[model samples]
Target: MTAPEPGTDGQSVRPRMAQHYSVAPEPDAPEGYVAPGMPGAPVAGYDPAPDPAEPSAGRRRRRRRRRTGLAVAVSATAMLVGALAYGAALSRVQSSIGWLAIALAAAVAWPLGRIGGQNRTLPPLGALLSATGLLLGQLLGQTLRLHRLEGTPYGELLGDALRIWRADRHPVDLAFYGIALIGGFLLTRRTASTD
Candidate 1:
């Protein structure tokens, strides 16, 4: 066989290679296949490298998600523990100790605000959830205690709990919620992405 001559452009005078094409399978589509353009169309060059900002953006997002989750978990745990502590103390200390529960609620905001993601809304959101949980816990304990005293039946306990949930809340309880809300706003701050 005769060797092919090189082009004057310093490139080999070679036959064109077979073109390659790829299509994604779609169940609902015709023939269960989907391609960018019609058949026999010129195949455009495709750069597989991802965008410059994609990895960083994704990493930051994942990091933020982790931080947000951590903040929420911590806040919730603090609120529950606080509620239980306050309930236990309430049974023991005769003097007023409501402030302790409020303080606990307020304290949750610090960690949440400090570690919660860039969303300025998260701190206050966490605080609100925590405060609400605290109030619910207190009400729950009160309802259980009252029900026990009244010798409430197991089947009717649900009704009693509902009544307690809808009962008029004390101003002190409202104050605690407000403190937690404000404290959350105060403690929350934007932090640099660690990743």
Candidate 2:
């Protein structure tokens, strides 16, 4: 085959080689071939030459995938550990406190799921605020339910606080706080991908 001559337009009209579309070189070993990494041995697809950039690109992709996997593994491990610790603590609590704690945990997880869905980053302050708000919401919800069931006036106070909270941007505040967790996860993933 004749090599195409370079032209002013920077296009070569040479026929394409089948190797261009093949993942591996022909099975027949070429004589005197030596792979860079395999030194002195006939490497599977050793050509006397190869693009230096190809190896680097592969390495980069592998590194990025490694980091992502590591992050996911660590996140899962942390969740499991925290759940176990909380369960142990919960078992030792009084029934009332246990139920309250379970309610609060459920509330906290809801916002956490939202944050994950949004894929946002959360700073430490935001984490603290959201956790506190979730716990408070659960506590208030339980208190209101209990008082209302007993047909007492205390339920009215909860209703008022809820109204004031709703009117005074409590929902917005909680949303802002929850956003942090999403942000944290997103930022971490972004960094991992780039690695």
Candidate 3:
């Protein structure tokens, strides 16, 4: 069989070659329309969709601050309650049950630290709050005791309480204080992530 001639059997060789090689034409775009990723595109009214998986930085920061604030408030309130309870008990009872304060401090501090979130500042904050609570409890107990015994005036109660607590200190009290400090510090430490 010989080579097919042009337009043979009503089919042109040029048309077949053109059909094989021709590229599809691009669609016409509207005026002022810029294709995505093109340089200097106006992008009028174009708001990029935010990523749902990742929150905005400002939102994250605000959330963190709110959490930290809540933690601090709750921890401080707990310490205040513990101190008041301890002081009340100590004032009423002549026996030395100060060791119980260690448990109270750890109990309050550990949960506070965990609630405070994973941060570098939590342990030190817990320890400071614990120490403050213990000191306040002692002073308050002494103040209440003096008030009960001598009807001490409100203005002079603090000074008298300080003097009384200073005079009443014992070596055993120091040991208990140190243990409380250690417990608060250690128990408030960040736990390993189970995740």
Candidate 4:
């Protein structure tokens, strides 16, 4: 420690000791030297400065959109798989297995609804998706049946399938389709509630 020096006014002044003590660093401090509690100072191996290589806002938004697009694509693929299974099952059996379509719609809608609920902004896309799946499954089953019975060509099955379904459509089938649409919409929608 240095001795106090006499001042011109008869008072003693303490020697400057900031360099030897734990204090805020000067603006011109050497690289890698940081004083405690200073902004941008590293603490516990953490750095506060933003990295130059970090993505910009637009890049981040694009990345998020890509991820969301990928998720929707995967969901659509799953819906197609479910529709194929429903059609195959119905074609092989003599009894009506239409109820399975309803179940599949609900199952697909549930996840979409849950995901939409979390966002609080996107409307549950599940209803439209599930309805499309139901229609596709029914069309597929009708096509398979027509091919088996009337020897419809593989290439023309889709058009013939649509024609047969239109000719043989029943009130009960419409009711089932309406029920599935309503159910899918309900499953995907989330209502806000007060605590």
Q: Best by lDDT, which number?
A: 3
Candidate order by decreasing TM-score: 3, 4, 1, 2
- Global Cα RMSD, each model: 15.9, 16.9, 10.5, 11.5
30-69: candidate 1 lDDT, tens digit per residue? 6635466967544679545687867766787888888888
Model 4 spans with C-alpha error above 4 angstroms: 1-67, 114-124, 190-195
Q: Which should have the higher TM-score, number 2 or number 4? A: 4
Residue-by-residue lDDT tens digits, candidate 4, 80-181: 888898787767776666667568666666555443333332224556677778788888888787778888686788987888778877777777776667
| Model 2 C-alpha lDDT per residue in residues 17-131, reported as the tens digit of each score | 5555446655566777665677576666657665775666668667655544443444444434444444344334423232233333333333333333222332232234334
TM-score, candidate number 2: 0.27
Per-prediction backbone clash count: 1, 8, 0, 0
Model 2 / residue 61 / CA error / Å: 1.5
| Candidate 3's TM-score | 0.66
Cα lDDT tens digits for candidate 3, 1-195? 766676757764654443443776665988777777789675779867879897877887788767767777887888888888888888898877788768667765765666667656777777778877888888888888888998968578999889878988999888777766777777777531211
| By lDDT: ranked, best first | 3, 4, 1, 2
Q: Which stretches of candidate 1 lie over 4 Å from their true place?
A: 1-57, 91-96, 151-158, 161-168, 189-195
- Full-model lDDT for every candidate: 0.63, 0.44, 0.75, 0.67
lDDT of 1: 0.63
lDDT of 4 at 126: 59
